[model samples]
Target: MEYITLNNGIKMPIVGTGTNTYGKENKDYNGALTNEIPELVTALELGYRSIDAAISYRNEELVGGILAESSVPREELFITTKIPAREEYVSSKESTRAAIDNSLKNFQTDYLDLLLIHAPIEDKEQLKNTWKVFEEYYEAGKLKAIGVSNFRKNHLDELKEFAKVKPAVNQIQINLKEKNEDLLALLQDEGITPVAWGPMKTEAHQQELLDEIGKAYDKSGAQVLLKYQIQRGVVVIPKSHNRANQAANLDLFDFELTAADVEKIENL
Candidate 1:
């Protein structure tokens, strides 16, 4: 798998599996927990190392258990999870610390490859306190790196007021539908990596365009879309329960898009 170097010098797999709906009934995001994630096992068997999870997904323990039980060693896996900005997890520094500790225990590991605030905190004080705790964990080696998700430029500017460590990534929607070109540029300028979620949520028209682009590379439209993002330095976590699609998602390293193809994709 290919990797991207974050601002803090830590390497992250450019491709990963998203677990937002894994282990849930019928693969529904809001479905009841089934306590088993066969898809995750398939992903691992297919050589996916990076796993993106979140506390709000309500299945961290199950996902963590599956990950821990896998044959892959902890060091080789790039595990990333998030702490929600809700009151329960961010009421105070202690609350945030407890949440992280529970996550570590759930994952059955001493340190996580990366941790992120699931979303922006509107309360400035709460945001500062939460970030401080993240910094503390990072400094103590409990977390390899720390970052935020769904943050806008103003939120980042607010964080810069007293932040000592720059956020390593900003997880956000980056499909052809949402584009988010401006924020993408800002992340580039700040040296923060962009992790794309819902990466396959392209419009039908866009898919047609991507399909046409893929014809030249002998790849699928989904592959073309993911390539467009990763080729421009964005990490993509496109999840699929189908084993073939999972394998196809990691099949991005074998080809390169020419500058003209990239430009066409950019303008699409």
Candidate 2:
């Protein structure tokens, strides 16, 4: 697996499995419907080492259930989870500690490879509060790296100016249908790793984005999507329930997309 170092100096795999189906639980996504906890184990067994989960997904424990039973050494996996919603903690440190405590418990691990604030950042005061806690965890050896999801350039900037530790990763939506260059530039400037979600255009109107890219690369839509993201130095963790899709998603190491080909697909 290819990996990139976060700003805080943690090496994270460029491609990982995202578990965000919504229908089975309170969330509005697909993972809830699939309830494919076995797939988590399957992915690990298949040789993919990174797993991204979130509290709101309500499957951390299920995932942990697998981790507890599996033999993928605690050090070999890059496990990440998120804080679902804003909690009224007295201090950011308190919030960070409590969340990590719960997450480690959920994942059945002793530490986190990466922890991200799972929503678009809103205000300076709130971010300061949160980053404070994130830093505390990092110093205490509970979290290896810290970042946010759904944050745009503006949000990244505000937090950056006051941040004690630069964000190690920013999880956002980036794919053929929507390539946010400004977002990409902003992230690249600080060496803040960009972790892309929905690299395959989930729920997008351009369902065939993959098919088109697939034809060019002689690969599946999923493989092409993941390839594009990694080519741009962005980490992507797309979710799939079908075993074939799971295998196809990670089968991207063999091929290379040219500059001309990349532009053609990037514009699509």
Candidate 3:
């Protein structure tokens, strides 16, 4: 896997596993929130050093549980977690500190590789307050780098006007179906790399487009979809409790999706 250097000089994996499920952490490890059987272990063993998560998922403890049990050294792993919205985080600024402290405690770590402000598109001041803690954390050497999630250009603009430290990344919904070239270009110009959550969009609205491209590559629709995003320099985090799909995502490094094949799948 390739790595993207954040503006702060932290090296982050260009690809990783996303853990987002809405359920109690006490369920079966595979039940979005329940199943922890072997998927987390599989991802680490597969050379995916980065793990993206958020508090809203209610799986941070499980994710942390898995990491603690793994042989992967904490230094070698790039673990990223987010502060949920204000109410959950409590108060934007103060909550970020408490949330991060809890994350470290739950994960059984002293510091985090990265931290992000989860979606707060409506409250601009609260967002800035949340970011202030991120800045403080970085300054304190508790977090290596900081960024945002599900943010649009306008939201970014609002951040820039108040932020002293520019975000290192913007995790968003980007895929073959929703190719926001305008936003991508804007982010590139600002030096913030775009990381995609649902990059293939096979679960969203790109199934038909993925189907067409799948035939050309002799690959599954999901494969073609992921390949297209990679070609555009978007970092993809495709999650699956299925070990086969997790392994399949790592195999993408070898194949080359032709330019014509990519154009054919554009925004369909």
Best candidate, lDDT-wise?
Answer: 1
List candidate 2 stretches off by more than 4 Å.
Answer: 22-36, 88-93, 121-123, 202-217
Candidates in order, TM-scores: namely 0.99, 0.88, 0.87
Q: In candidate 2, what are the lDDT values of residues 1-268, reduced to their tens digit?
A: 8888777677898889887662255444543444446667678878878988888777787777777788888898898898854654323567756777888898887888988988854656767878888888888998888888888877876886888888888888887656777888888987888888877764353447656667866897667767877987999888876678888888899899888767766566
Better model by TM-score: candidate 1 vs candidate 3? 1
Error of 3 at 240 (Å): 0.4
Candidate 3: clashing pairs of residues: 27-34, 28-34, 28-35, 29-34, 29-35, 29-36, 30-35, 31-35
Flag regions of model 3 displaced more than 4 Å. Answer: 22-37, 88-92, 203-218
lDDT of 1 by residue, 1-268 (tens): 9899999899999999999999999999999999789999999999999999999999989989998999999999999999999999999999999999999999999999999999999999999999999999999999999999999999999999989999999999998889999999999998999999998987788789889989989999999989988999999999999999999999999999999988887787
Name the runs in model 1 displaced over 4 angstroms: none
Model 2 vs. true fold: TM: 0.88
Candidate 3 lDDT tens digits, 217-245:
66777877777776777778888777788
Top candidate when judged by TM-score against the true structure: 1
Error of 3 at 65 (Å): 1.4
lDDT (Cα) of model 2: 0.78
